[model samples]
Target chain A: MATLKQVAAHAEVSVQTVSNALNAPHRLRADTLERVNRSIELLNYRPNRNARSLRTSAVELIGYCVPNWPHQTHLVMDQFLHALCAAAERTGRHILLFTAPPGVDGMPTYDDLHARRMVDGFVLSQTETHDPRHGWLKDEGIPFVSFGRVWKESTQPGPWVDVDGATGSAIAVRHLYDTGRRRIAFLGWPKSSGLAEDRVAGWRTACKELGLPTNGMAVRCREDSIEEGALATARLLDSGRDLDGIVALSDVLALGALRELTARGIVPGRDVGVVGYDDSPLAEVVSPGLTSLRQPMDRIAEELITILTGDQQPAERLLLPELVIRGSSAPG
Target chain B: MATLKQVAAHAEVSVQTVSNALNAPHRLRADTLERVNRSIELLNYRPNRNARSLRTSAVELIGYCVPNWPHQTHLVMDQFLHALCAAAERTGRHILLFTAPPGVDGMPTYDDLHARRMVDGFVLSQTETHDPRHGWLKDEGIPFVSFGRVWKESTQPGPWVDVDGATGSAIAVRHLYDTGRRRIAFLGWPKSSGLAEDRVAGWRTACKELGLPTNGMAVRCREDSIEEGALATARLLDSGRDLDGIVALSDVLALGALRELTARGIVPGRDVGVVGYDDSPLAEVVSPGLTSLRQPMDRIAEELITILTGDQQPAERLLLPELVIRGSSAPG
Candidate 1:
């Protein structure tokens, strides 16, 4: 309840003397230390733990920054955070979450937090091709590991763990093809996103190998949201394309597609099969549970912590996603 | 990257002299201050923001503690966090997230963070009747606001913002009754949670007011997960209780009930009307979109931030929940 200033006033000493008495008693005179201790006991002052930790360099904190977008539902990222916390605990570390100030071109708050030593390192998520965090962190020689990777041409090798999106998408396409679905469509975000491009490329590769048409079957949205997915699916349906199967880049999109299909009197599993990425919990509850690709969130979290804590080498680790077959993609 | 110790070593002074030079130059000799500044510039030593803030007593950080339960999908909590972050930003404050050490009876980590002054205060979530956090924080005189409330009899209210769970349930029950449903079943968690009891009380009150039987329709589960919900629904159906309506305590349970009903060839809206709480985004995607109670998360967040930032009185504020009607509860 009492602050160091209050204790200092009560003891008739400088605030520094009171702080030193609590954190580094050897630096204070014996009489001064005794007087400070007496005042602390009288005022019931709880020594600020952060101040003591700062003096001794014992702040074992790791930070992760989430974008300040209120409308977005980060279901997969939430799961990843939960796993990351567990992994950090295993290493006797704690996680500190901060929001990325919106509209900032580069992460300035990250530099501030680093300079202040508020955290030992950061666990960067959603890394992009030209991510400014990569250059800033590397130049400052700050210890950090990303949940994603930089551009292929950047040649900036760093510690990262990401899901193999291409493999995940290819598995979805193969499953649909095996189920006798010929007219499969790919729904993804607009070009320039590395992850989305990887997913679309896998769909194209599968179509080429199986002699299925790829032209006019791929569509893009400005964002990865359920509303966008619904709008995209509506546009596809209105475009007069006869699609038998649909592979969505994310589960949110797949859910939107299912909603649109149901609104148009089309049963998802029977009339038009639907498969989604990121086997979120919602995937199971939907009628005719969605077939989806499950990212190894736990493994990714473990890998990130291992690299950040100096337990493993700094290398990019790409884990394969597992396809979970539900009723949504069952053969009619 | 240079620490205060490194700066002190380079300047031929003590660590306290380097700290004083950055934070309280008047307290140090002119020669000492000049030497420390020169060494700082030479070593490119950035003064730790946290340490400087500590000296000036200006750390505008509020903390929130999340449980480290991986098996639980905190869908509602995630939305609440997003809203809380936005609300905090409106007041020029930032949120710092920490995890409650698993298996620990009391929040020792919270005590440590507070002692170290890592945050100004905390925004506590999931306040239980016998919550250890309540006693510890209250005894320590820590400034915090709970997202939930303690038991009705405790009478030790400090600050809290919670939804009227009883009113939400009553609204659900009244809606079902008005829809000409007589046999309305209540599904909830096993006793011990005050919030859950409040919800079940609403159901009982509605049943008593309408002269309907309440003894055989109430059911309990060990957890609030979807799998448990499905098992409970299956058990209820197997009992042949002739229930025509259901009000689940949560959307997860309601979703599970829908899955079980569809599996048994019992249409939800046409045969057995279903209503869930917490109108999660997933509620709209499920077939026969679920009728649910929408908790005003944004308002709650706003109230919490207002209380935490000393802009409002420390009193309990209970917001009303809105009932969102959908196809799941439509009349046959």
Candidate 2:
């Protein structure tokens, strides 16, 4: 049961060199590899280090629960999953995907997989303030990293990497303001969602700094969908808010607003600037192209995998989203 | 090393009774469970059955190469992946996702995962004729099932479950024909792709059966994208083909056609009937809901898992795509 450092000491080499001797022998001289192997045998390290080596020889697996929202568009999650797979592969790990039984959350499956050692750790997404999985996994002393904030009230914290939604909205507001837009309205989802509220905060801060009227300039939708967005836009227009720009929290809502504007013969970009978030494929495909904020999904995935695999205490990373200007946000 | 059947015989119980004793003990009577355990010890069946039970106790994993087509919209694959994950979970398996190195295909990663015993089998998609992975996996004596056909010219074939693209096109054609559209045109990709050709075949067959002119009715695009589809639609129109309906091979192409028609002040349903394949979210979100063919992804995933886990020989399943009628194909 000798530690890797002890094996390194016995072999008269660095700990990294001992690891290279076992995992990447080509990186070491023949004599060094021989010395490390000799030390490993003499110290009876097979029980600990050899077993670990055998496990490492195969691909390590990280479990992810595939969210089943059939009616919802999954462009963001789809992009993130692809990026996560690429990031995990770079570190010799793979993503093992599971789904809960119909109408159930993924806790039971997570428990079963953890109990049986099917995964080294987990990568979570779509987490909320009171997600039971966070507390449950923490209580079980399991390793996990979420793509979004855990938002839990606990003495201990979980690792996470999230996009700066507030900053994304702030950037959108500033861009719209700089483009001759004095009155910018925010189209956002219900405030019950932490993620949605974060975006709204950005809009509020940016509007107040720009000395623009904030009263009656923001509209909340029941959900993030095209229909809801259109309905909210209709309310903004009918209320005589005299808005010249609209910054929607998601592309779906933005597209909905565009649909309403087009129906009323009001040209987007020319008459009323419109911007959305996520920069999904729909953004580019939509006519006049959608001005959107693009989250750094690849970088976030890389960070998540790093935190999940590295033997470090939990880390929190908040990355800024980049505003991608398109025809919809073109200055008049 | 005694088998489960032998253990059942020794315990004077049904095979299900013995299995329940090990896996679902609550389903068995206390005395029956005791008898099964006693028989297992008496016959020294622990070596074989215990190992098998232990292996099954942990979730079996099916390897999937996460296709990294960043620009392409992945509605179909995204839906299929969710379905596959759900289906795998129902049968006590999971999907292990790996991505190939940037700019590389997935063969190397697949071989690595298979060599390490990290997965029980594979589920492939985006497969093409003469796909090297099929031949390579066959040579390696690995188990795999493709969501698409492996059109390799080999005696030993791979198991696959594919949606009938030809039938999908035929259904579109027939639907368009029945909807008072006398002249139906086909917008499809170049002939090099086996899948595109299959779809074209359906259009051709249906066009001929309905005694419609096949010549000069089909237009081929270099790729299946919105832009290419628009260009192809333009070509079809400028050629004076007098087509009143268009059936696109994919939703992207169909959306492109819609964009072109809308730009030219031509209404979709009234001026030119349109239908698309893959019934993606775009089909619903598009201005005029697109009438498209919906692939039975859930059923296909179920069949693929059944073939992969069962000891049966390779099976080929060709499920039909259902045409979902919507605004784009409404009768005028």
Candidate 3:
């Protein structure tokens, strides 16, 4: 409920100055803009949403559709969403997270938003291998972009953007090799998620190039959950695989793998080096401070909104993931 | 693409019978209903969402207002959101992750739907201490149920529903006290969050009731993160307070606290009794699995939606949480 006037008081500026920084950004000096912004955040100022929205028949609402179809999707990219949200505001758009179980048998369904024109367009998550949603959106000509491309997508046209999973996974395996871990093991996704599958493929390719023995070096899970990942790791070890380095396909699985290793009295960075993907905050907090492939969620989000808003074109943008060497994969 | 004919084929029933069983439930026998339901799940059948929603103007969109209004949030609970999304599908509502940033600054903002009338209502998350969102929604008569209720709003007429945080925290602390740990430390969230503050209050009240000393019992958050929690735990131990039990406000924090305890060569649940909030999947994956509080998101969602669409007066609702005892806080 903090107002522009309050923000102005904190920034030692006039109401108009505060107003310009918010509405007419180009009108203010750069330093003044910075000060005004700092004051607003400091005050927890929310310009009356309803009233501001009333001014524009188009309320800066950006709709996100993360289909909770077939298997449930948790949508853990807060780092991505949070960053994209900040970028969307820069474009004067607000985000509305939209997901629904497709009723009937359970296909992905959108509530009245799609049918009633509730959104200007959508930023969808987890583009299916053969996405019906993509075709439907194309047929309807609704403005939208996928967080990833569908299997059939040629050149990933039509406002879609993504973090290249194939490249990221390869980078993870390559890092393990670089860190003096020759016998690398991949604990990967078992199911049919395009991204997960891509990571697995990347790992296989990395192993093939490195000339590492692929036999019994791979662990799979029906899902990328911590339980599935942990259980899979345990199962793989119990199955008696000789592995020196482990590169998990996801942060969750990495955490799970970390636990499994811990239970067996294995030191992560020493006994069996570990590396995770997604670089979720959990990766940073685990005991060994997990080494991970950092997905530039902010960069992807930046490009996603840019493409969706027509400021940029639909391009298969690959943001290079940097390997954060933490204690889990810290050189012993 | 899967139709009633396909469902009938899978279930070995005629299309007419399948239709009768699904739409005309009263016309079907009890055995038929059970078979159809079982077949529906077995086939992973999701009735084409558009077809089912084609009749209702409801657009079927469920808005999730992900609180990104210039504040820190916990991470583990996000995994639960995936589960909740799955649960919502069972009930036929899609979840839209919504975030209203704080205006141009980083306060709070909502969707254009707030004005354009695009969405049915909202599932507001991170209820503040004195949330004006509740008041505004009430004034506008917009349907919304909070994921967690605003602090100081127990008596207000509400369409809000949430897990009983106080009760959950009390359960964890009482368990600790029963196990003969009197000097307990609470780690977690900032004082701003009504929910976190409530957890701290619950810990304090429980400690006083058990006639334990208040010296070592304190709620502190250097930062609202697991790394923060770990660092805080380290600092707390270093500060030379006689601490026997620790109740972390979140699973991520508890994980961090566990790491901190172990780094000091202290065994969690043995040398120190540790309890965590949010029995996230990681709670089970960690070695010496974390004993944590479970929030009933499904219950929260069900009650909220029932109030939103159901013919019920606006009233507050609270769902009791479960204390899942695991290895992290195994009773001695």
Candidate 4:
């Protein structure tokens, strides 16, 4: 690691002359260029400086760091990530992917990425109330954006975009009520996730606001899986609760409920009614079909990019989740 | 931008001296370093480079470029990507993310990063038959590794680590036959993707090898969505085809197939056995569960990282997808 100045001193020239000879040779005498080049070779120097210092820049890559995914093999997230990868290409940004498995106390080695400067700003998904990644990025001064909001505060930190989970759930519940269903049930994930919590709150609030039951059969979900949904449905039925309508937080759970109902000789539209969220393209494929709320995928994708690139500021952009009415909850 | 050499010349020093002043000042004579620094300030010359280059030498950046993964959203690559990222960190390396979008064709703008030099090598994913990125990267003469192999012969082509799709499919078919399922149907993506094509080929080969019938009731699905799977199942049933057993390319599709069977008053595991690939968390979530093949995500991830870091130069690594027996394929 000999210094370029040492070489310059050895060559009996000022540093400016050395810089001119090495970087802007045309502005320097040919002999000066030759001497400076020889000095650089002698020093065995490699320009390991950050690319930002350069006048011309490269948009050769982009990156995403999803740490709070529900699970590794989750079917829904799997599909979203795939779409993101494809979408990244459109922006001339490639996804540098990273995962931080939760450790004890629900914290992972997120600082490792920040310390080493892994990728250019990251695309963070599944924001929580007090996400550590947000503060860590600020301390490390790394650029990043989120797929969901990190806090419930009025003046939130960071640029983030998210699917309208609350609105979707509210719409589902509203639809069920409209179909003359008084006792509606909400099925889906445990109330641990921020998104799930939002959906749950919306369900309960809608019921209370609409003068419907706020507890008991109003919410009968125990978990996120299809089996759990089915098992929960069976429990609701066995408990002799008067539930006539159902709104699941997710299509997968809704599907499980449907299976349980069908097995019990219950027809979705006639005997009981159901509505699913995510519209998951699966709603249309299911028999009797399913009424669902479709997420605004393109808008989320676009907003995420804009924020990550510093092209957009922190703003609450909520796109309406479309209510798709299929056979399952067609007001029959 | 004012060139470093111009600064050096203006400051009356060799370019090496100027570089030493900015990049390695401590190694130069204090007086000389001061002179170079003063000259740089006077000339205001800057180098064009990726922001990452400015970090310490021994650049450990290993970029991974993907060709838009729209279909991958459901696959939840978090576990795999996280493992790879963790491995890279252990070996003192970083992963760069890059994606190619719809309108953008050929290589992304790499003027600053590639030309000015940002990363040491790359880790490419979703390699196509004749990947344009491959040719362009090859021309740049950058050392790289791949999670998938590019088509055609290349001079000093990078190493690849991919799942053995053909083997997995064949095993699935054989398992069905072993279970006394002679009229088993195949359900999966169209024969386009190299991996998908391999699975189809393997299914056919396995059928032929086992002397089993390959016609009728077998479904060729266009997508791996659960809804698509259900629709395909409905199609087969509507056609009145005799399908004793079914193999879906993905867990989502298999779940859909199970739903269709339920709708038609058919017991999934008892009446007609069903199997799925991907072993998604959803597989275990569904009632009667699902018999599926599981890809070794962690192993593939580790292999990709090791190869990219030059710890190993594997020509191509093939991982076996194991069959996870579940309730869906259990005979009553």
TM-scores of the candidates are 0.63, 0.76, 0.61, 0.70
Sort the candidates on TM-score, descending order: 2, 4, 1, 3
Best by TM-score: 2
- Maximum-lDDT candidate: 2
DockQ of 3: 0.10
Residue B278, model 3, lDDT? 74
In candidate 1, what are the lDDT values of residues A29-133, reduced to their tens digit?
899899999999999998666564664353466878765455556666667776887788778676766666543354667765555445678898866567778
Candidate 1 chain A worst ten-residue window by lDDT: A50-59
Model 2 residue B107 distance off true place after TM-score fit, in angstroms: 2.7
Q: Evaluated on chain B only, what are the TM-scores of all the candidate structures, in order?
A: 0.78, 0.80, 0.71, 0.75
lDDT tens readout by residue for model 3, A1-332: 68667999999998867866776465579999999999999999986554433323434456664443433434355666777776776786667555554432222244234433345677777666666666666555667777777764564546667677777778877777777888878888756666777777888888899898788778777766766777888887887776678888878888778877876788889877898886766776666788988877778888878877774354556677778888898664
Q: Score residue B189 of candidate 4 by CA lDDT.
A: 80
Better of 1 and 3 by DockQ: 1
Most DockQ-accurate candidate = 2
The residue pairs in collision within model 1 are A48-B115, A49-B115, A49-B116, A50-B116
Give the distance in Å from residue A282's predicted Cα in candidate 4 to where it truly belongs: 4.4
